[model samples]
Target: MTLAATIAPQLPYLRRYARALAGNQGGGDAYVVAMLEALVEDPRLFDGDCDSRIATYRAFSRVWNAMTTAYDAARDLEAPHHRLDKITPLPRQAFLLTAVEGFSPDQAAQVLECAPAAFSKLVETAGREIGAQVPADALIIEDEPLIAMDLEHLVAGLGHKVVGNPRTRSEAVDMAHALRPGLVLADMHLADGSSGLDAVNDILKSFDIPVVFITAHPELLLTGQRPEPTFLIAKPFDEDMVRAVISQALFFRTGEPAPAA
Candidate 1:
């Protein structure tokens, strides 16, 4: 396959990881653009040895770590609005690569250009950062009693209050209005045939809530078609994975109004 064809399928995921690393979409995408420019200027920077996905992320890490003029300007402009200023950048990237991006330790280590042992340390440090974050009231929008209960337990376990667990779209919206949760964990399909996407959209219309979407088919939403959730948990999720994404969503959330339509 041509280089573009090889890299095309990875862009959406790269965008997701970039956003997580930068704490916002605009900053994250800026880094992605820089990475692309760097690759265009010096194609040798793309490691031919690694798989395209790993190589792509490795390229991004170079851009992120370089602290180019673009990076500094963007960071200065976004510092007032982001919460990532407190966390060390390397640990955050390691955590996002492995925990949120589904990279194995070896692959993530490749992306960060770190030894496996060092990668483990970075992930541990990131976990500590997650534990130290300020807690907030969380809402769960799920239809399954078992799943809802599990989510409530998980949210509460993280020191966040379980404000409400709504099982339907209308109920989700109503409860969100009443509780005004700081975080929302939502399922993609509701018991009443309502879409979790629609419910989140309706709530976003009223509040700039940070959301972590949970779904069996995450690829359905991950398509690079429109604005998508920055944090996502696939179904049959590992508890640690859910915790990581929840922390990320809460960590970067600024409660600013949703972008203008």
Candidate 2:
């Protein structure tokens, strides 16, 4: 079968898997698209002699693993209190199979490489864990007016508040000192060319606030070897992904061990 023909039937399943892995819908969809793009770009990865069903399953697994690894590497550079620490491996896999993909217990178990009973137990554990990790508030610091406004709307929609919108590093520092917000969303290059790192450092100097750096220059954040609780959301963003990051940050900040929503 052609590439599209082979992959089309699995789109729904892929989306479900993404949501389970991402703990939200938008991030899940992005992962599915990213996986498809990867498949298109590198056909040889799926050219194995195994059965087509098994090969296709493996392809999806590879993409999920790549995305998870990339996310983990990016997350580790953040401060421990700022990163979302709820997503464990087993539930993440079970969520992909059962929730997003609509797989039966037996089928989902097959995909996750585990027995049906084991998979069910994993799902229950993940559900309880995710419930425990949801956050109650958010912090925002964007220099651009329009982008900041959009972010505000997104945060509010997630039932969170925008504690403040500090345009400069000093403003952000002062706000963090004042509010002690549960979560902070900042732009990397601020109006003063000072960068969000300055704001983050200042906040860290005083209070333990988790931060999500939204920027056009993700490469800058990627290169640094920082600790956890600091995450990077590249510009031209997906609203859902931003929400997921914010939720994760808030959970990390509060020391609540819940998965992403």
lDDT of each: 0.77, 0.63
Q: After superposition, how far is residue 40 of candidate 2 from its true place, in Å?
A: 28
Q: Which lDDT tens digits does candidate 1 get at residues 1-261?
A: 766677779899999887766667887888888888888898887887888999988987888888744334235435433444455778778777876688876788899998977876776566556646656777899888898898888777666778788989999998888877778899999988989899999998886878899889899899999988888878887665676677767655666523333
Q: Any idea what lDDT model 1 has?
A: 0.77
- Please give the distance, in angstroms, between residue 41's alpha carbon in candidate 1 and its true position after superposition: 27
Candidate 2 on 144-253: residue-level lDDT in tens? Answer: 89999999887776566676888888888877776777777888888887768778888777655567888888877786576533567788885545654555455334
- Give stretches of model 2 more than 4 Å off: 1-133, 224-230, 252-261
| C-alpha RMSD for every candidate | 7.2, 13.4
Candidate number with greatest TM-score? 1
Taking all chains together, the TM-score of candidate 1 against the true structure is 0.57
lDDT of model number 2: 0.63
